[model samples]
Structures are given as structure tokens and as C-alpha cells.
Target: MNDNSSRPLRLGTRRSKLAMAQSGQVAQAVQQLTGRPVELVEITTYGDVSRESLAQIGGTGVFVSALRDALLAGEIDFAVHSLKDLPTKQPEDLALAAIPPREDPRDVLVARDGLTFETLPEGSRIGTGSPRRMAQLNAWARELGKEIETVPIRGNIDTRIGFVTKGELDAVVLAAAGLSRIGRSAEVSQFLEPDAVLPAPGQGALAIECAMTNAPLAATLAELDDPYTRVAVTAERSLLAALEAGCSAPVGALADLSPSPDEQIVTEMRLRGVVGTTDGKTLVQLSITGPVPSSSEEAVAMGHELAAAMLDKGAAGLMGERAL
Candidate 1:
């Protein structure tokens, strides 16, 4: 330990309920790991206050910049972010210190009357803001010989669920991890399989970031890193970066661990990806499993290779120029 245990660490977080709840868990983990007191510093983000839709404002970066600024300005020692909201490119002065163990990385349907996807009435309206979700839902509807309408909506989970409770929509899709974090997992009526609807890259994970210059704090935060989660997210995000896609692009990826015979912490990354148009037409999906990555660099290479395979199949043209 760098012996910073005597001083309380400041953890920056968005003021939203989900953000606070997630930050609280990280704070407790820090306390238990280092015997240090942690203070929560609420930081408002552009995404929190802006009325512009996430897609119109260019995806989740609006939720991330303010926190990074706080860390760089020394307003807080570190900031916790929903990994899916972070940009693939990182600021040179910031170091991603840790990726804790992930929660369920599947998207779940929160519906009225506890209805599953199959049982939802034809032309039922479902609310979601993610292009990936919209595309996948449309594709799934086509697969089942059904028609459902996707409404563009954005808000905190409670507000989203209200649309269903108030009969504004028949259902909503949300990350199972978010509901689980806020103690509302029981609201989920069904878990969307990755084959039918993959999750966003890095969804259901947290990214702990600190100033690169703060070696002691960064080292301390690294203590909480889960190697399995780190490798999985690395491969997923590597595809996003390699494909030159933004956070809101109609792209979904997930990487999970497979059993290994050696007991040396070796794990294989079985990664799946999807790319499609928002209307559900021109959908392309693929899967590839890579051998145990000896280093983060190797893990990222596997992602690039997998992306190359997808691109070779015209996935890039299907994505069009909207990857911006």
C-alpha cells in the first residue's frame, strides 16, 4: 500500500440515483480494501441536465466529460463511470484504474402485466433510446413474425418504467445490471438473449479513473481490479475503437470467459458482436473465441481480428457513415 490510508479519498459521481448507488458500492469497497474513509462528491454532468436526446447529443460522452474534468482539475481524486458511457478514446492524462467484477450483462424487458416478448401484442410500443437496442428489437420482432413499435425515449429508470405504468408504452428495455444495482431486478419480465439482442460494449461494468500523475491513488484503485472483467471489457471496447464507432452506434458486443484447464488464472474470451441499421434491416451478427490473452495488448488484438472478420462481410457498409 502507498500509505494514503490516513487521508480520506474523494470519489466523484453523478448526482443521479443510479450513479450514487453505484458509487456508494465502490466507496465501500475502497474502505474495506485500504481501510480508508471515502467521501462522495456529487458532480452534475451534461447528460444529467440536458434535455437533448442522447443520440442527438452524440451518445453517452455527455455523461462522462464533466467527471473526467473533475478528476483532472483535482476537484476529486477519482470518478466512477458506467463503462458503456465512456468514450473509446481516453484522455492521455487519465488512467483507467480498475474494472470491478461485472454484473449480468444482458438487457431485460420491463413490461406491463409481466408480459414477455413473445406475448407482447403486435404493434406494441416499446421505449428505448439506444440505437443498438432499437435495431436488435426490430430484428427480433421480424424473427418472430411479429411487429412492434420502438419509441425513442430517455430518462432515469424510474421515469422510463413510469411510461409502462402509466400506459404510455407497453414495455421498456433496460440493462439488467442497472436494475440489479438499484435493487429493482424483480421488475424484469425477461432477459434478452445475446444471440437475439447483444448488449452495448462495456455495458454492466464500471470504470474507475484517476489522474495519471496520482500514482499512489491509481495504484490503490488498481487493487480493486478484476482481471476477468478487465479482459472481457478490453476485447469488447477494442472492437468499438477498432471499428471507429461512437458509443451510440448500432453496435453491440459482449465477451465472456470460458473454462480453462490450467489453474493459472488463464481464461479465454468468447466474444459476440452485432451490427445493424436502426430500422432492423441489414443486420449482421458474428462470434469468435480467442485463446487466453497473455496481455491486454493481446486481448485487444483478438478484438481487432474479430472486427476485421465482421467488416470483411460488409458490416462496415451496413453501418454506413453513421459510425461517427
Candidate 2:
């Protein structure tokens, strides 16, 4: 291993407020772990500059390619990424060094006059950049016998919330983890339950990546890895890969420990997945419970099992993509 003992480690991250905040937290943890100085290296990504929606720009890796380039170029020693934004496919040259414990993976609403989704006036406009959120929200509205317009939007938290503040939209939906990390959770009007709307795969998690060749650094970073978090997200992302869906696709997945029959110790896990059209006309949601995976292989198998069941129920047809 190359000697990195005397030099500061460079942590590449995007230039967004949320990105910087999360990266800073990780940097602090890394410094304490390795007793070495850490530096933040901000890189601009195509997703940050493009006015086009994520789906329009090929959402899977738009925000991540530049950072990966920096890692390969040795401009940064490592990078921190919002796991949800990462592509399901891991490159051969890089190593996912660690995944720390996750935050709350639910979606939250910020509405005008402190209004909840159910209480929002009829025909209210709800803004969000995620097709997953739109599909579920519209479906819920239909169940409530109310009308809501899910407007397509793309921007940082401020820009998205501005629409509501400026009266251009009635509310905007965002990840609960994001608002909490930025000390703005107090502004949330409602926390969207996962029962009604599962979050995007790996939604509340962070991925720390390093060059696969950097064995020493990778080992050091691995100290931060949380096995439970890794296994859960692995199952979720595996389902995403099995579905052959990009991050922009209207797919949501979540996995958690399931209680035993006695409702005491947890020895099993439950994985739930959803696929729907952007318009919310149809949805295929299914779940599977099995032993808590002790290895990545087991978790992946569980996801494949669930994906197969969903496919049998026309999940592929809903994604408008290739048949699996």
C-alpha cells in the first residue's frame, strides 16, 4: 500500500448544500477514525448544471460520473455519494469502501400553511423530481377521492421549496433524511409513510468509495461500514438491478429486519418493491420475507426472488422496458 500517512485525504463531493453537508459529516468521521486531515473537493456534475429532468439526462449515473473520474484520476482519494443516486452496477475499478448507518428513509411534505397531504385543498399542485413519489402520491389521492396535480420539477431544496413559498405550487415532496441532515426537519408538514410510498432504493444511505487498488485506505474506511445497513440496501438495490430500472424509473424499494414469530428477537428480513407508471394508472407492488442475509449473495438472491414474483405480476410491462 502506498504511504498516505503524511498527506491529507481528498474527499470528492458534489457542490450542492446537502451534498456538502453530508460529505462534511463523513469527513469528520474519517478524520477521527484515521487521525489524518481530510479535505473536501467539490466537483460539478452534469446533473447539477443541466436544466433537463433526471430522466431526460439519463439519471442512473449523471451525478456520479464526474466524481468517479476524479477518483480514477487521483484528484481525490475517495468520494461520498448519496447511495440512491448511485448506479446499481458497481464498476470493476472502484471499491465501495463503506456504508454507514442509514437515516430515516421516508419522504416528507412541505406544504403551505402547514397543510398535510390529506388536508391540502382539492386540485393542489405537488412538486417533485421523482417519478416514484409522483406515482404513489397520485395513487393515494385517487384513493382519498381527491384531485392533485403532480408537477414535474428539478432543483435543489431551496428551488423546489421556492415554488411553494411563491405560490407557484401548493407543496413539494423531499427525502426526510435530507431535511433532517440540513437542520430543516422542523419545516416538514408530514412524513409520508413507507406503507403508502416506499422510498427509492438506498434512499437514506451514503456510499464511501475508494480505488480498489488502495487496499490500505479501503480497509481503513471499512471500519465505518455497518453490516445491517449494507445488507438491507444490497437487497433493495439488487431488486432495482433485477428490474433493469434506472434511478429515474418509477421504482421504489425498502428492506428491514422482520420480527420473529414471538415478536422478540429479529432473525428475518422483509423486502418490499414497487413499480408503477409515472401517471399512477397501474402499479405492481410485492414483498418477500426470508432470513436476514448473512452475505451479499443471499441478499441478492432474496431480491431476485421478489423481482421474479413482481415480474410475473406484470412489473416489467409497467416499466416500459425490456422483458426480463
Candidate 3:
């Protein structure tokens, strides 16, 4: 071990409640793994301070760059990030050290009067900052012959849910994993399955990143990496990269594993991708199932192949600046 092994590992994270909660969890794990104390270094990010909606201010990346800057400056040893917030392109100087096991990737509905999405009355107002959710919700509403208005919203989970409680909105769409991490999943009235609404690529997963030059620390963090989750999200993010879409784009993707009959082994992997207009009038969704990827190369290829198929079906037209 290097002399620094005895030093407390500083984990850079945003100061948001959700960010702190998740970072605390990772810090505990690192302390256990390295037999050293870990410290939380709270950093304010542009996304956290900006009242502007995500799409207007530049999507999820805004929440990440500040921490990345801290890492590159050697002010923090590593960082924890919601995987969905990471840009498709990785910085050359950093390493994605690990991807912990995922949480539930479904989107959840929290409605007033304990209403599920389907039970909500027509013309009910739903608040969400996600274009992907708006597109799918509109499409789903049309299918049910119901009309609901999607209002653009921005805030942390508490503020978002407050909208419903205050009668400002009928409901809100949020990531089930986020609520679960914050111990608020019980408030969810409905879990929107991938069948109706695919989640953003890499949703429900956490990424631990460190300076690539720090091989010893990177190797230590790699111990927490779950192979299945890594491959699954690799395929998902690769698809996003292939589509040339940013995190704010109206694009959703998920890569799921099919377990064997014994439920002890994964036998196949299924990749799904969707691109749609925010209005929900047009959508292009596609899926592909194949043997579980044995290597990272295979996973990347699978995503590229699936992305190609979606593009052939006119997925690009649905994306505004998301096109190649």
C-alpha cells in the first residue's frame, strides 16, 4: 500500500439530499474496503444552483462537472455520481472505477389523493423536468383516450412532491431508485414499468470515478463493481452515445437481463431504446434480445447494433438535436 493508503479518502459529491445520501452509502463501503476512514466533501454544482429547467441550462452534465473539476485538481480522492447524469463522452484523465449494483430503474408516480397514473382524471396536471417522461406519458395518455397536461418542473424530490401536496400539480414523475435511496419510495402511487416508459440509460446505477493515474485506488474500487450491472449499463450508455443524444434528449433506453429458469444465472440480455417528440405525437421504440455479453466489447457491439436498428426506423427524426 502507498503512504496515502492511511489517508482518509475524500469523496466529492453535490450537497443535495439525494446526492449526500448516496455518497454516504458509497463512503461507508469504501471505508470498509480500504480499512481507512472516508470523508464526504460536499460541492455545490451549477445544476443545483440554477433555477432554470435542465434542458434550458444544459442537462445532467451540469451536476457533474464541478465534482470532476474537484477530482482533477486533486482536491478529492474520488467521486460518486448518479450514472444517468454523466455525459456520453468520458474525460481522458478520469476512470470510471466501479458501477455498483443497480436499484429499481422504473419511473414512479406520486399523485395527490393516492392516485395512480391511470386513475388520475382527465386534464390532470403532471409535473416533471424530463422530456423523456413527457413524451412517453403523452403517448400513453393518448392510448388510454385520456387527456393530461404535462407541466415542466424543476427541483429536488421534496420540492417536486410538494407540487402535488400544495395542489399546484396533480402528480409528478420521478425515478423510483432515487426515492428508494432517500427512503421515500413508499410515497409512490405507481411504478411506471419499462413496457410503457423506458428509463434513461444508466438510471438506478451509481458510478465511482477516480483519476485514471491512481491505479491502486482504482483497483480497490473495482472490487465493488458488479459485472452484470456494468455490462448492462455499458450497453445502455453505448446506445446513447451511438444515437448522439444528450441526457436531456427525449430518449430512453434500458438493458435488462433474463435469468434462467433456476433464477440463479442470467441467460440472455435484452436492450430497449426509444426516441420521441416531447408532444408524444411521434415515437420510435425498438428492442433486441441476445445472449448475455461475455465481454465489454460484446456489450458495446450489442448497443451499437440496437441503435442502428432504431435509427433505421426513423428514430433520428424524433430527436431534435439528437441526430447524427
Candidate 4:
């Protein structure tokens, strides 16, 4: 997987501050792993240019299409993406070359007054546009018999958090990974537990993609891959696909590798999945744990099995309400 040439690897990235920061980290890591120089190629995408909200623009392929296009067109040798932004279906011509070690996979609350999900006052308003978060938050609030409002919001982390400073909203929910990526983790008031709010599948992960034709490049990129992280996210994304859920749908899944404590060797991998309506009226959740995965296919199969279990418990009807 050695690059004999001196040319730098062109890493395509969206031109947002967050995307640039993410790409910069990836570029350094890939360069160190492959012994290849890496360059960041900024690309403007429909999602970045559109004034419309994420729901209006459609969700799955928004931020990623331009990068994929650049890769397919040979404009960039490789690209990086927030794995959650990627669709479940893989393209025949493009290969997901690597998924590096993930960051914190849990969501966080950036609330005023250092408040948390449990400590937030009754009727407190929370801001988030993600159906996955909204649904789970609503369901939890209902279970607690606390009447909190979930406001729809769209923008970068700074803009979303601004609502609290401007007194436009009480609080906002954001991924812990995003805040951490930009060195803003200090701003997080509280990290929500996964049991309270299951994170979007592949929330804290990155997808490195390259054209399928580039075997040498693929091998180089694969050197940067963390098999455990890849397998875990594969299980999560596989659940999403088996459920026929869109990336924007109120579906959340998290997979973890639980190694035996004494030996520090992975013994089992557990996956938990949730499906719910936007209104939080109906929610279906399931979990499955078995032997540690030996291959990508086994990990994906575990996710499908969990999805089927949830579907048997009326996960489909809960998801159906999302369309209505």
C-alpha cells in the first residue's frame, strides 16, 4: 500500500468549518497511516448552499452527493464524511474504504444554567430538528409526565446554541462528537445517556470513500480503518437499512463492543435499536447481543436480526406514522 509517487492524496471535504476541521484531522491521520501526503479539497454542496431546512432538502444524500460526485469524477482520490450523513445503500462504483475509530457516540444537551435532561424544569423548551432526537426526547418526557417543547431548528452548532444566549430558546440538543470536533466540548452542559436518547446511527464516526477501481488507494485507506468501529457502525447502519428508514427518520441505533474485563479481549458485541414516530406517541425498541463479530457480514447480520425483532413489536407502524 505504499505510494511511490510524491503527489498528495486529494481529500474532498465540504467547506463548512466543522467539515474542514474534520477533514483536517482525517488528512493528518491518513497521511501518517499511508505515508502519503494529503490535501483537503473543499467542495460546496447543495445542503450547504440551500437556505431550506434539512427536511426540505431531503436528508440522506445532501451533504455527501457532491463529495461522492467528485470522487467518481476523479476530482478527488478520496473523501471523508460524517457516517450518519451517508445512506445505508452502498454504490457499486464507490467503496467505503475505511471507518476510523469513533468519538463519543452519545448526544449532549447544551442547555442554559448547566441543566441536564433530568434537571431541566418542567415545560422547558428544547431545540432540535432531528426526528430521531425529537421522538426519543418526547417519549421520555411523556414517560416522566413532564411537558417540554421540542422546537425545530436548523443551522450549525454555533447558530443552534445561539438560541439559548439570545433567549430565543431554552436549550438545544447536539451530538457530543460535533462539539468535541471543534474543541467546543467545554460548552456542553450535559451528556445525555444512550438509554435516555439513543444516538443517530454512526453518529460519531467518519466514512472514508474512494473509487472502487483504485485498489492501491483502497488498500492504503484500509490501513487507517478500525475494524471494531467499522463493524459496530455496520451493525447500526444495517439496522437502519433493514427497517427501510431514511437517515432523517426517527430511528436511532448504537452498537458497542464489550470485551471481557479480565483479558481485555472482545467477547460480545451488543446492538440496541429504536424506532419511533415524530410525535413520540409510539416507540419500538430492541437489543441483541452475541459473540464478537469476526467479519463485516456477521456484524451486519446482527443488526438485521435486531431490526426484525423491533419490527415484530410494531416498529413498522411506529415508522409509518412518520410518513403521515
Per-model TM against the reference: 0.95, 0.97, 0.98, 0.95
Candidate 1 segments exceeding 4 Å error: 1-6, 261-266, 320-324
Candidate 2 ranges with C-alpha deviation above 4 Å: 259-265, 320-324
Q: After superposition, how far is residue 212 of candidate 3 from its true place, in Å?
A: 0.7
Estimate, for each residue in 1-324, the C-alpha lDDT of model 2 and write its tens digit: 347587899999999999999999999999999999999999999999999988778788999999999999989999999999999889999999999999999999999999999999999999998888898898889889999999999999889989999999999999999998899999899999998899999999999999998998999999999998999999999999998889888999999887778988769899999999877889899999889999999999998999999989998877743322
lDDT of each: 0.89, 0.92, 0.93, 0.89
Root-mean-square deviation (CA) per prediction = 2.1, 1.7, 1.4, 2.2
Q: Write the per-residue lDDT of candidate 1 for residues 1-324, one digit (tens) a residue.
A: 134557788899999899999999999998887787999999999999988777788774889999998988888989999999999877899999999999999999999999999999999999998989999999889989999999999899999999999999999999999999999999999999887889999999999999999998889899999888888888999898877778888899999788767756556768888888988977878889877676788879978988898888877765532544
**Residue runs of model 3 more than 4 Å from their true location after superposition:** none
Model 4: lDDT of residue 128: 95
Report the lDDT tens digits of candidate 4 across residue range 70-170. Answer: 99888999999999999899899998999999999999999988888888899999999798899999999999888889998988888999999888888
